[model samples]
Target: MKRVVAVFRQQKFEDVKRALLAIGCEGMTISEVKGRGRQLGVKESYRGSNYCIDLIPKTRLELIVNEDDLEDVIDTIIESARTGEIGDGKIFVSDVEEVIRIRTGERGSKAV
Candidate 1:
């Protein structure tokens, strides 16, 4: 099993979701998150004051799927999320040892 964590600009969430679904990902969890990357956030001016906003708002999408499906999922996310600009966010993949569905007690890939 694998856990895919994709983070991207808030505005690109819809595009990423659509791409994921087109690639056969039926389930996912999305969250609003704030983070900084190499460029280190952005600058904002409020009330005539300028300040460095080091923590930028982003959308985080997480999904768990069989190992065999990992590559397709990653490709979908990357293609959808790419904007050729900074703050496009990142995607991280990791191994998941096990998964269990709470309601049915399904384990392993069945739990997904």
Candidate 2:
């Protein structure tokens, strides 16, 4: 098993979600996050004052998939999230030792 963590600009969440669903992804966890990427951030003006925003809004998606599905899931996220621009975000995959479904007391792959 593997855990895929994908972070992208917030506005791209819907696009990524749709792609995931199209690929038959069962479930995922979503989060609103803020961070700086290679783009660093941008500047804004208000009342004749200017300020730099270092941390920008982002969306994080976390899901666990069987080993066989790892590449497909990563590809889906990238294709959906990439905007051909900076601050597009990143994806990380980690080894998962186990998974358990508390309600049914099922463990391992079945739990997932």
Candidate 3:
């Protein structure tokens, strides 16, 4: 099993969610997060004053999937989240040792 963690532009959340669902992903955890990458957030001007936002708002989506579905899930997220611009965000994949359903006591891939 694997855990896919994607952090992307907030505006692209709907697109990413839809694409994931279309590909048969049944569940995921979504969060509103603040982070900075190499771009280091952004700058803005107001009333002749300039300011830097060191932490930019982003959307985070996390899901667990079988090894066979890892590539597809990553591709779907990228295709939906890409904006060809800086701050478009990133994806992280990690090994998942196990998954257990609290209610049904299901474990492993079946629980996922």
Against the true structure, whose TM-score is highest? 3
What is the Cα-based TM-score of model 1? Answer: 0.93
Model 1 residue 42 CA deviation in Å: 1.0
Error of 1 at 38 (Å): 0.7
Local accuracy of candidate 1 as per-residue lDDT tens digits, 3-98: 999989999999998888888898999999998989696888999999998989899999998988998998898899999998788989999998
- Residues 40-83, candidate 3, lDDT per residue (tens digit)? 86899999999999999999999999999999999999999999
Clashes of 1: 0
Which portions of model 2 show Cα errors greater than 4 Å?
A: none
TM-score winner, 1 or 2 = 2
Task: Give TM per candidate.
Answer: 0.93, 0.96, 0.97
Candidate 2, residues 15-98: lDDT per residue as tens digits?
999999999996999999999978888999999999999999999999999999899999999999999998899999999998
Clashing pairs in 1: none
